[model samples]
Target: MIQGDTYYFAVHLSKYYPFSKRVDRNYYKVEISNKSEPSYKFYTIKELSENNKYIEAVSIPPKKEGYFLEREEKHRNEY
Candidate 1:
C-alpha cells in the first residue's frame, strides 16, 4: 500500500450459491479518500472485464487441505 505503487489482488470464490450468483448487470465504483487529509474522491467505473486494461484474471489451482498447516507444523517440529 505504498504511495503511487501498483498492487494486484486476487479473489477466489467457491462453488456456492452466493459466490456463483449471476448478475444481469453489474455496476462498479471506486472511492479514494485520505483520512489524514480529510478529503474524498470517487469515480464510477465504466467497464470491468476479465483481461482488461485495468484488471486481468489468472487461473491458479486450488490449494489442497493442510497445505499451509503442514509447512507450519514442519517448522514447529524443528524448533
Candidate 2:
C-alpha cells in the first residue's frame, strides 16, 4: 500500500460456538503509514444520516495531478 493512502478491505469473521459457524463481511478503510514499523492504520466507516465533515479535515490530499492514477498504472505494470 502507498504511504498515506487509504484502501478498503473486506473483513471476514468466523465463529465456532455451540457447534455453530457463521461468516460476516465488513468493510474498513486502512490508511498506510511509514512512521511506525506496522506501516498502516485501520478505521471503520460507519453509516451516518448526514455527511461526515470530520473526514475532510483529516483526509490526505493528493500530492499532484494524476497522483493516484500514476500509482495504479505503476502497480498494474509491475504485476
Candidate 3:
C-alpha cells in the first residue's frame, strides 16, 4: 500500500446559515495536494462522493515521487 498525506474537510448544513436556507448536504470531491512547494502533486477522486458526506477525509499516496498528485477534474451528480 502507498503511504499518503491525510486531509480533512467539513461541510455545514443547518436550517439557517448566514440567514439563508440550509444548503443541501454534499459529499466532497477530494482534491489532494502536497501543499509543500517544490513537490506539488495531487490527484482527484473519479467518483466517490456518495461514499463521503458532510465531512470527508482521506489519505492519498504520492504519485511517483514525494510530489503530491493533484485532482484534475470532478463531477457530482445524483444517482
Candidate 4:
C-alpha cells in the first residue's frame, strides 16, 4: 500500500478434513503481504470466528502499488 495506508485481510476456510471440517471466517488481524513478499503471511490461520465481517478491510493511498491486482478488480466491478 502507500506510505500510511492500511490493509486488512479476510481469511476464509472451507470445509476440510472429514469430521473436523468447519468454516472459520474472520477478518485477518493484519494485512497480508502477497506470496512473493519478504514477510511471512498468515496463509493458513488456525482459528477464526464464524461471523466475522469487515467493510473494505484493505485501503490504498494515491500511489500504492502493492494491491495492483485488487485495484484492477475493484475498477472493473465499479463500472
Q: Write down the RMSD of all candidates, one decimal each.
A: 13.8, 16.4, 16.8, 14.8
Clashing pairs in 3: 41-68, 41-69, 41-70, 42-68, 42-69, 42-70, 43-69, 43-70, 44-71
Model 1 RMSD to the real structure?
13.8
lDDT of 2 by residue, 1-79 (tens): 4435544443332322221123434422332222322223233344211225435433646657498788888899675
The residue ranges of model 3 lying beyond 4 angstroms of the native Cα positions read: 1-4, 15-48, 51-79
TM-score of model number 1: 0.19
- For lDDT, the strongest prediction is 2
- Give the per-residue lDDT of model 3 (tens digit) for 4-51: 665423233332322122335542222333232212222233233333
TM-score of each: 0.19, 0.27, 0.18, 0.18
Assess candidate 1 and give its lDDT. Answer: 0.34
> By descending TM-score, how would the candidates be arranged?
2, 1, 4, 3
Q: Could you give me the TM-score of model 2 versus the true structure?
A: 0.27
Candidate 4 on 1-79: residue-level lDDT in tens? 3234433353343423221223345322332332322133322222221213222222324355658768787798676
Per-residue C-alpha lDDT of model 1 across residues 1-79, encoded as one tens digit per residue: 2355433222333332221222233422233222222122221232222225334222444366488678788798685
* Candidate whose TM-score is highest: 2
Could you tell me how far off, in angstroms, the CA of residue 63 lies in candidate 4 after the best superposition?
A: 38
